[model samples]
Target: MLIFSKAKLVFLSMPKTGTTAYETALSPFASQYVCDPPELKHAPVYRYNRFFRPMLEKFVSPDIETLAVVREPIDWLGSWYRYRHRPFLAGKPTSTAGMSFDAFVQAYCKGSRPAFANVGSQVNFVKPQPNGTKVDHLFRYENQSGLLTFLEERLGIKIELARENVSPAMPLSLSPEVEEKLRRKCAEEFELWESIT
Candidate 1:
C-alpha cells in the first residue's frame, strides 16, 4: 500500500492487479510505503481499517480517500495459476505444476479450495466496511490510462509504471462448462470487475 498524506489518498494494493508496478513507481513520493511483509504490502480494506486507518485518522486526515484496482476475474485467476506454476514453486503445495488451467479454476470454485487454487477474492478485499470505509476510487486493471491519469492529477506528479512480478507465459483457457461454474460460484468477483467501468 502507498499513502500520500498530502494528497489525502491511500492506494490499496490488490494482489495480481499490477500493484507492484505502481508501488515501484510511486513509493518514492508516498508518505508511507508498506512494501515489506507480504501481509502488509497487500493489506486489504478490512485490514487497513483495523490497523492503519485509525493511525492515519489521528495523524493524517480523517477523510483520506482510498484507491484500489481490480482485474477481470478469470484473467486474475489465470495470473495466479501461471505465477504458481513458475519454476521456483515446483515442489510447493501452492504450485500449479502439472495442472491444467481448467482444473485449477475448477478447484478454485470448490467450497474448500486446494492449496494451489486458494487465491483470495478481490471482491472481499475491496468490500465496504460497516463504518462506511471503502475505496473512494476503483479502477479496472484493464484501464491503466484512466488510473494513471487520476494518480498523476491527484498527486501532481508525472507517473510511470514498470512491469513487475509478471507470471510466466503460457496458453491458458477454461472449458465453457467450468467457466460457467466459476461464474455461478463466484458471481461477486465478476460483478465487481464489471461494475468498475
Candidate 2:
C-alpha cells in the first residue's frame, strides 16, 4: 500500500500473491535485507516493515522502495486453501479445514477462529500503508505487463514470473454460495486482487 519515490525499494510482501517470486526478481535492485514475508502473526507486514523502516532509512542512503502484489479475495482465498492443503500440509487443516469456506468466514467475522493460518483474514490488506505514499512503486499482479514495465523502467530490472497464478475458475470443493458470500464480504480484498496478484 506504499509508493516510494527517490528512495531505495522494498517489497512489503503479502501472502501468496507471488510475493516470493517478486522477491527473487526484484532482489538485484534492492538492499541485502531482502527477506520473504513472515508467517501468521496477526499483524500486517507494513507494520513490521515500517517499524524497521526508520532504522533502514537512518542507516542507509535512501529508504527501501515498498512494493507488494495483491489478489482478489475469492481467488486469493481459494488459492490459499489449495496452497496450504498441498502435500506438505496435507494432513493439516486447509483454509476450509474445519468447515466450509462460508462457515469459516462467518466465524471469522464474528470473532471466532480463523479460516486459514496465512493471509485469510481481511485485516491482512485492510491496514493503511505504513510509509504513507512515499514507499516508491507497487505493481499489480493482474497487470503483469505493466508491472514488468514498471520494474524495468524504475528498477532497471527485467525478469519473468510464473504464469500459474491467474485463472477463471477457483480451486474445486468450494460451493458457489460460499464463494459468493466470501466475495461480497471481502469486496475490498477483491478490489485489491488486480493490484496484489
lDDT of each: 0.95, 0.52
Q: Stretches of candidate 1 above 4 Å error? A: none
Models 1 onward score TM values of 0.98, 0.68
Candidate 2 displacement at residue 78 in angstroms: 1.3
Which is the leading candidate under lDDT? Answer: 1
Flag regions of model 2 displaced more than 4 Å. Answer: 1-7, 36-45, 61-64, 93-110, 115-118, 129-138, 162-170, 191-197
Candidate 1 per-residue lDDT over residues 1-197, each given as its tens digit? 99999999999999999999999999999999998899999999999999999999999999899999999999999999999999889989999999899999999999999899999999999989999999999999999999999999999999878899999899998999999999999999999999988
Instruction: Name the lDDT of candidate 1.
Output: 0.95
What's the residue-level lDDT of 17 in candidate 1? 94
For every model shown, the clashing-pair count is 0, 16
User: Model 1 compared with the native: what TM-score?
Assistant: 0.98
Report the Cα lDDT for candidate 2: 0.52
